[model samples]
Target: MAHIPAHSDPARQGAPTTSSRYELLTLGDELLLGLTANAHLTWIGAQLGRRGVQLQRNVTVTDEADAIAAQFRESWARADVVITTGGLGPTCDDRTREVLAAVLGQKLVFDPRTEEAIRARFAKFQRVPTANNLKQAYRFERGEVLPNANGTAPGLWVEQEGKLLIMLPGPPNELQPMFTEQVIPRLAARGKLSDQEAYIQIRSIGIGESALETMFECTFSRSPGLGIAFCAHQGQVDCRISSPDGRYGMEKLRAIASECAALLGDNLLCFGHDSIAQVVADQLKQQGRTLAVAEASTGGMLANAFADLCGACKFFQGGIVSTSNEAKMLMLECPECLLKQHGAVSPECAVAMASGVAEKLGADYGLAITGFSGPCTGGGENPLGSIYIGLHSPHGDWAKQLTYPGPRAAVKQRAINDAIDWLRREVLKETHRIAAPQVN
Candidate 1:
């Protein structure tokens, strides 16, 4: 893995570089409790990444004035621009205005424009504005008020003490549009017009991080102006390539990455940003086939993965989650005799589940996942992480056994990915076999 690009290399050596990069500070007590999500920072960072600006550091603080001021000071000291979301409301806990005033040696004065807007909003809701709501109009020295399309609380943009500060409301509906329309263009104008780095990610499965790293160690080390990163999980790996060449950019980078992946052979799964489910969905589209799923131990995850794919309704015929033996027999029409004899975790049971789903749904193919995804025992005292995935086609039904090593949730997730990968491979193989010459 490579370090964050902005932090590793200084834009210019020694001299003070012009205002270019930014630091994001998200303020809310909910973030600390893991209740309120911090989506603004991620959204802004992604947007900035598309441009040339880089977000150096991110800090999350409660609505406390002291904590917000301390973080604001620290962030601005390192970054030329600072962006904050949350704590802009008129509630007693909202202290963003006071903190910004303290940091910039200014006082918050009531603005008539903000006050009228707040009052109008409350009137539309058939309510009277409270005294606390008057704080919404507070503004700092020479600060510009950015309109909020979706909310009453306006965003603030201030430049002082050789640093740029921007504050927006917490709600995504307000934050996203305001940041795009009001903040981004201003930042671009203030910063230098440097060529942006291109980013490309190659998603793969059934390959370990160490092996993937070794496969490209030499190539990445020698590749000029390219940054490569590998993110590994239980069932998947992502190879991220970022190059600092604006011209021919991602196109050129993707071509090189495809060549590197080809070197790794079949270990390379999907190209670009497609997940395993997305890749499988693409295969179904190409073959003009629809798929249905029968999930057991993996719950509905296998089916849910396909449903989450974009335009899934085009080829996914839905699925059934036979969580219990009764559901399997009743809903999916799995043979009660087979379940009693072979057990639900057995490959035979998985085969029946897949075939039953395919026949019932009238889909071209069906995928089923069954096994012990827990601390429970399976056939012949087989320990946890024992899983079976079956694929049923018009020709026949076949199942594959997988033994993954991880926690209960990890095991289930791994099984789901493995099941999808198996179906993907089968689709490729079946297509190739059908296209092959028959030696009659």
Candidate 2:
């Protein structure tokens, strides 16, 4: 048995600094093969960050016994706490259970309480527990059980030589509640956290990565305990900051955020974790306004985004996918001659679409997106990834033309993000204003 020490300093007071390290290990062939998005990593990272725990490394391995055991040993050596997800199911490839037994020099013993919980869960579904289900009742020797109210799998928490190893089920519903209920209390009691860490995400649009990095040159260079990272996608940059001490960190975050807000000006969409769609919906809700959309190049993605939110049906009004010029002319009331003159991907066409949809749907505002998202289609001279977005509101009709160089899916996302930014500016009515497009 490899010996590891348990938490040495469980009792500390007044948020005095104590260093605590963390590592995440995900076990599943599906994760290694990239069959499904690793949703757990982001959720776990955010959850721990809120509690001042910084996960240093995230490792993913297939369901191979040797590979799993090796990662376990390496992670335990480096970090005080290690969290593993997946490989706990009843299937044959579930290797976490046996590997833990081998590495810890212990045997898996059936725990009757776990069996009772599993049986009770099955009873609710009007089914009997099969013999195979008993495998879930087994726990590592001297391990504590994490009851899962949502599922049959019970999580395991173990400690040796002072280090903590928590094995959680892969499914979010099971893992989330268990961690919240059983794991958080134990972790908070560790008293291993060095300084109370503070994390904040500042989301902005219309700023390039190089520009943001250059602006923060001295800021990042000087702060030793402060960590900073930037993620750019769909025409926005997410600026993340981590500070060691909570009070001092929050003060620094506020000052730096104020400077960023001033520098980015209208380009800054929001501070914190709000999505562009959510921001737009919040503004619309505040103003008690409504919206409708007409999409061609982007399909109905704009509509779908609004639909994802609650109370959308009340304010979203409706939308039309006028893919063909005939629908644009007949359904949206755009003049046929305009389609012939400017083509579907032109700013003039976008304006017409927006203006027509707003009138057709009897909405306060209308948005239209048109573009060539991919390589030239049907031998047209229009450049690929050229997008034009139009907005018609009580004030006036406006359009913005941007040439984004990316693949098909990326172009559509950029268009949607830009459109959302336009909405944000209109609702706020401060900062830089998008000029109305010229109508022929």
lDDT of each: 0.79, 0.79
Cα deviation at 91, candidate 2, in Å, is: 0.8
The TM-score values for the models, in the order shown, are 0.80, 0.82
What C-alpha lDDT, on a 0 to 100 scale, does residue 88 get in candidate 1?
88
Misplaced by over 4 Å in model 1 are 1-19, 33-43, 106-134, 137-141, 144-154, 159-163, 171-197, 221-225, 244-252, 375-382, 430-440
Score candidate 1 by TM-score against the native: 0.80
**How would you encode candidate 2's per-residue C-alpha lDDT over 1-440 as one tens digit per residue?**
10111223333221224467889998899987889778888988877765656678999988999999998889988888889998887778887977976887777889999999999999999999888778888998878888889998889998877888899999998989888787887787777443343455667887788898887777666666666789987778988775544334355655666666677777777776667888787777766778889999888998788878888876788889998999999999989998999898888999999989989988888899998888555235568888889999888999888878878888888888888778777766721232345569
Off by over 4 Å in 2: 1-18, 116-130, 177-182, 189-197, 218-227, 241-249, 310-315, 326-337, 360-362, 375-381, 430-440
- lDDT at residue 299 of model 1 (Cα atoms): 79
